[model samples]
Target chain A: MSVLDRRRGEIGLGDVASALRSLRPADADDVASIAGVLGFGLRAADLNAQPAPTPAIYDHQRPLTPQRPQQTPSHERLPGWAMPPLLPAPEPLPDDVLPSQIFRESPLAGGGEERPAWLGEAYRLLPQERATPLRHALLPARTARGVLVAALATWRTGSEIDVTELTRLLAEQRMPQRLPSLPVATLERGCQLLLDFSDSMVPWWEDLRELAQQAIAVLGDDLVSAYEFAGTPAEAQRWDVERERLVAWRPEAERPILVATDFGIRGTPSLRHGGAEWRAFVARCVSVGAPLLFFVPWSRGYWPSHLGLHPQIVHWHPATSAAMLRRQRGLSRRVAR
Target chain B: MSHYTPRNFTLPADYCFRGDPRDPAESAADPYIFSREAVIAVDVALATGRPLLVAGPPGCGKSRLAETMAAVLRWNFVYQTITSRTRLEQLTVEVDHLRRLNDAHLAARSTSPHALADRDEEYYHPGIFWWAFDAHSARRRGLPESVARPRSEPRFPGVERKPPDEAREGTVLLLDEIDKAEPDLPNDLLEPLDRGSFGLPDGRTLRAQDGAQRLTVITTNRERELPPAFVRRCVTLLLAEPAREALVAIAAVRAPQAEKTLVEKVADRIEALRQELDESGRRPPGTSEFLDAVNTCQQLRIAVDSPDWEETWQQIELVTLRKPMVTEDERSRPA
Candidate 1:
């Protein structure tokens, strides 16, 4: 017998079934060749038969629910069968797996409730202390001005002449010319201000909060929305520029969001537990296309962790001085615009 | 001479066009897929006669946009790649001090006064902006001057000049990677950019001719913060990272010989890898890396569906995407 014939004869029904399962025939010729190699009389019914679906090692769909492990003989060996050893059953997920549940219990997750007693008492004792009115420092606007004088200058003469130079005959018929107004560059978008009010930021909390309030006031209440993030984000009341008092705000996703944070707390238990919460907030920020701006305190020397090194984050050091913070915030607002 | 209309002109063979539809033979191939916002930004920049300041991540086609626009408009193109030491005067006119010194020495030895006067003009070499402005003038005057003017003289002794026919219709000045220059450069650009003119050291002003305003395209990788006053003068466009479908299309264009499935797989893997890197706080690979990997795969002739393909892909990825010294803190974090 020929080598091809011998090889064809060696092919069994099992081999044909395996080949049919794996091969995706491009055309009728490929299908015929595959069938011919098997040395079997190919029937339409055999080709049409659907292969049994392989059992999944891990059930990812219902992650929390336990699944029964698959049973296969430990030492059963089949010809040409190549598969990895069956994986052990997956472990059950932790009870506090959800971020929302963890966030509710964490002291770092700020609201009026979980904060220090002193902070709450201070707010109650001090009659709604208004933030100081910000003095706007105006920088000189740089303008480019020049005379566009050209040699062999073409001037249309009848009643109109565009001439920078005046000669004898040219001066006689020279008419006053009004150049076309130059186009003004306009900013089409506004920014949303996101403030970080986590527990680690206790020292700079009042100053940063006041800065955020001033930013909102300067940018106009309608143009900006203030957000405070501790364990999760909350819409903070902004100080209205017109009224000169704190006013309520609603979160809007349309404007460009600029997140302000110190990113100081890295190793605290609450922060460690709130990792998922941080990720979710980041994902939401990314989904909404928000740009983060880090407001670092100079003395703390705190660096952002891996979670804080997101591509969207921009860093700014706002030291104790409120003037510097206001300047940086104003610059950021301009840059965003 | 007839006025050159961009709508009617065709891109010539010699020009080395960089991005999308890169194959010269495939004339109908549409390589670039521009977003609606990008198109609108370009339209606005053109309409207002403002320089388009395109800021984006490296290798995301900020510089390529200039070449693409020039090709689309069928205009004359000039590129100035900015570096740290690039002087402000180099943008307009560079006086050859050594040449002037040599010429002065020769004039002092010679008897003719005309030679000394003739050499003064020779010392002042025209820069890229001058070329663009002059080319615009040549077009307006209906002169037989080449659409793209050749440099007056070589920067150094034996450098050969490019062939003349390479010049096309009008001018598009591409100030590529402007952020690489000194902090003051962008601010210095504001005056010339706003006036559409600048004065040479010799007191002669190089201005844009009457009708046409030379299109200026400035690209920045955002390495440093540009002055706000300078940024305010130009129309800005931020090119965000492209979506998966756009990236796949870009990959296919970059490696035309590779199978569609193979290109898609590479693009998907690249996207996933980028995400992984971003999460790990490592600098992620951009479009250039994706292109390099796809090109390498095509050159190696690796079959996408074969068992060996995965191993080959991993090897290629090491060179292209893998950064040395991934942070230990990132690796230890829970998934």
Candidate 2:
């Protein structure tokens, strides 16, 4: 049979050969030229019906919409936001207590009864007297995934915390459930709760702030830090001003950590400005050595004991998760050694 | 477009690669989102012509991104959707029975010793990969058919006198939902992706354009990580959930008639639900769920805030959060 009838399916060696033979000399030359570039060529068709031309692989598609300009939400527009004024900053913790503390915790200190029952036994076996809280929670990595693991630690710290376990805990805590059902109002409520907690009603907030400052001292200005907040437009504006102030004072060499506090209910979704603006906040933190943290309400169910950032993220852990606490103790011991 | 036949399968028209479709109010203000990250990823894949792995929770727009890539490249995108049952032979052409019969007849009638000597070589049928390969080869040769015919055609248009040895320059191949396939399925692509040729079970290897061929994009839902050996052959891109406002903007575009507040509310709810699932160690709902959920609400004319439709609305939410898995589980369960 001729090459045409010898062809298999709509496309085959015989069909290709026949089509190539049928092509005009120019077409054949074109194929030859392309083949030359690709280091191959089509076999010439024996019969005269022109071979089908090869399809073009790359075609132009309509360009996506250009990125929106960076918007700085007005202070009035920010939702229930508030920012600590840029003043004489309190001294952060010693270097031993910062990122280095991640490795010092007790791996065998804690476990959730349902998720991980081993921690209870581990806590019992440990020499440390303060092992009660350590027995209940797992490390962030042992429980969470994604951004939540890293983000969670910044939200709440257990009696003992490890930084790297944040992402896993956040992932475990926020996945499929909290994120999908989270309401805008609820987010706002969470932010309000955070701000309200700081109003001196809760001794825990003060103690936590002191510990945070101590940790910040240990890590230095280069530590990457992240925070999550909820609030109304007014609160968002307050945060905007505070964030701007922090950016203005930040040294060029010491990058600022990302502070992912909400702007308002209706303001910019993601806003970045300056090497220090709210937008580039996360990247700046990465440049430094801090873990980004978020502050939300206990009720929001998103208090990730950890948050996961990019590969470069240095997660912080809290006392809530047992695994993190144990790791923290281990690291502390190592530093003492 | 005319050369391809009308097929029952087509991607949704209003597909957006980023953000939520169920909520509009929050998203309307920033309706246009140019994902520099995603765009750069597509560019990198095109430049290197390497397979891309996109992983994320559901509704992160992994599949839509593939479609968007096809559109942007202006290529005749062909998605070879795979399931658990898919085999390598299905992608590689199997031996054709009709061709085998013709070969046998010819073998019996062959009077010449030379023709009879090669009887075993003629028993194969050209498979889909070969069809795509040959068609791509013809198009690179500047054949008129390549420009006009989409991939849906029954017969790849235009016959030639000989098989073309040249490979096409820019054909785009989308391996959709590859996670649904066997875990080892990715290994099947290693040789073809790297060498530009696939070996058949019969021992014949088909080479497209000798080595230069189409751009291949593989998508996964991150159900499991592929073996490192296979992953080394590809560039990886991880997709994250967009913020609520971004989703709202997408919703406005897809559901223009819906009230903005209503859209925002829905998006918020969906986001909350997803996070909750994540927190609970459950798989979050995907972008498809968000779209279908909104469509369901619209069809029933139910207000998102109304308490009367709470049960139905919750069901819709659950459906989105747990799709094919729950459905399949239900089917397999004993009554």
Candidate 3:
């Protein structure tokens, strides 16, 4: 016989009787079937011989009556063997107990708030050395002499026909003549400059950073705001003009953002989405009537073709020489003014 | 310079020539919304007789501006799409070498004494710019008309026909997507574009007749930076994205059958999606995509704000809004 058969043999008639009593079978056939399954000799009368004890009466005013046993809903009911023992409920805390008390008792009480690993690493990787201050004299003008000449020429001849004047002449009996006048032009405006500190701009990092410092120093308060941009714009603070040091950056926005970078939007994974973001940024600037300029080391090599051309964006490049740098500075000064 | 008047000309039936300078209905059935700056730039370019260099995003009506100008002014239109392989010669004239050789062989074999063999003008096929130049000159001299009507009939059915007249004078040369060509192409165009003339390899000169300056319109997507020298010679215009109201006006003409409410809904959805895509660093859907969605919805007879509208839109958006490569991943994600 197998182990199962030996175990069944070990269970006596008394054990079978106790099991049948606990089951509380309703029918005589059920009682007989339970006894037969357990290999015990039993009749319906044998189960009836020992009935369960009754409960004591507690209330004198009411007649002694047995409470009907609670019935388990069919859907919620589980087999007796499958049901697990219920766990003890947790004790409620006293009203006097404060949250701070609990916190103080915990191991992490003194640990402070947790930060992501990457953010901490980024902070660590931030540049510590102060950039060399670019000389203001070495910086170039904002707009070229040729561009200025062209602007002047356009101003002189590029004007709308005086339609009202023409109509007045026609109404009177005189030949309508073409009369042109220059439109009101804003020569100076406050501008913002963005310095690129992204990984792609590492090659010209020092030069661009120094240029930004130089611009701020020369333009003084005319430069509305200066920012350091990687994936997004962050305002540079703690400006030590003499020492040429920018201590920290916080997120900010200013109009007419002149960015100094390689214009490499394809550098990082985040920049894969940079094209759309950059375009939207530019569109926002345009909507607000702000000029967005891109200052690059080499305009031909660094400029993104995908951005297309924009009148708002004045791409100043190839400022490798002191003369060119001075020209760019002059241009920036003009724009800032 | 005198303003060239179009004689015996009739506007296309589909086009509504309102004659109002403020309204662009004279250009096409749909009115073009030119920004005040763009208008000034165009006027300046016309006055100076310089090529107007328009730089803008792809499909932002850079090329269409030239076509509209041609249609509005009743000038003969000539367009050339530049590619990486486009050569200077292709822009001027294409020499039929094989045909020339065949003509030479035929001339040599001919026994007739009267037969003369010469590198005739027949061997030279004029390019787009050449055609524009020749047409303008032809119109000026009152010579035989070389301009031919488009072979394809009007695409719009049941459109009324307008009265025909004598061929119009002058030509509008549209050099589209010039940035797609080599960087040197723009630089090469400087001399011809400024002088209104270029020389052929066969020692013949092709020059615009006096007082008949061809209106040259050059469009760039900024795929390449144009030479500063080239830029300096031309009047420049930068076309930006239109406002929502402007877009709605544009839609009224482009998709006349689409319901106003439907167009507004589509445009709003497109604008929202564009912003979301831009923020998330994805390629935002363009004006063309929005128009396509509106057209598809109209054709499919999908009613707006119906019980199944949301469900239907979810399906339609897959084909229209989602980029091809990103569609599968976008589908699997929860809406």
**Fnat scores for every prediction:** 0.00, 0.00, 0.00
In what order do the candidates fall by lDDT, top score first? 3, 1, 2
Candidate 2, CAPRI quality class derived from DockQ: incorrect
**On residues A190-295, what C-alpha lDDT tens digit does candidate 1 reach at each position?**
3555555555555555555444433332232234455444434433334222222333334344344555555535433234334565566566665655444444
Q: Write the per-residue lDDT of candidate 3 for residues A197-285, one digit (tens) a residue.
A: 55566566545544544443222233334555554433223332222233343223333456666555543433343577567666666
Question: Candidate 3 regions off by >4 Å?
Answer: A1-132, A135-337, B1-31, B106-117, B136-168, B329-335
Considering TM-score, which of the candidate structures 1 and 2 is the better prediction for this target?
1
Docking tier of model 3: it is incorrect
Q: Report the C-alpha lDDT of model 2 over A1-337, residue by residue, as the tens digit.
A: 3523422221223433432343322444444422221212442211111111101100012121122112234443222222222234358877675344345665775565466567555454446556445322112322322222223233222222232354466667742322221111000001111222222213233333333333222221113131212331112211111112111113122222322222221222232212223334444444654333333222223222122332122222333443543364346436535
lDDT of 3 at A129: 92
lDDT of 2 by residue, B1-335 (tens): 01111111122233233332333342211222334334434444444455666656556776666654544333344557776555565665544444444445676787532333233323333344555465543322222342543222234321111212552334456677665554346677665665556765456656665443455667765543354555555545666677787777666766777767667777888788876654433456655566677777787788867777678766776665554343545444432
Give TM per candidate.
0.46, 0.39, 0.45
Q: By DockQ, is 1 or 2 better?
A: 1
lDDT tens digits by residue: candidate 3, B119-215: 2444455666566666533222212246343222122111112212753356678898886664357777865786666777576667766555457
Q: Give the poorly placed runs of model 1, Cα more than 4 Å off.
A: A1-337, B1-30, B109-119, B136-169, B323-335
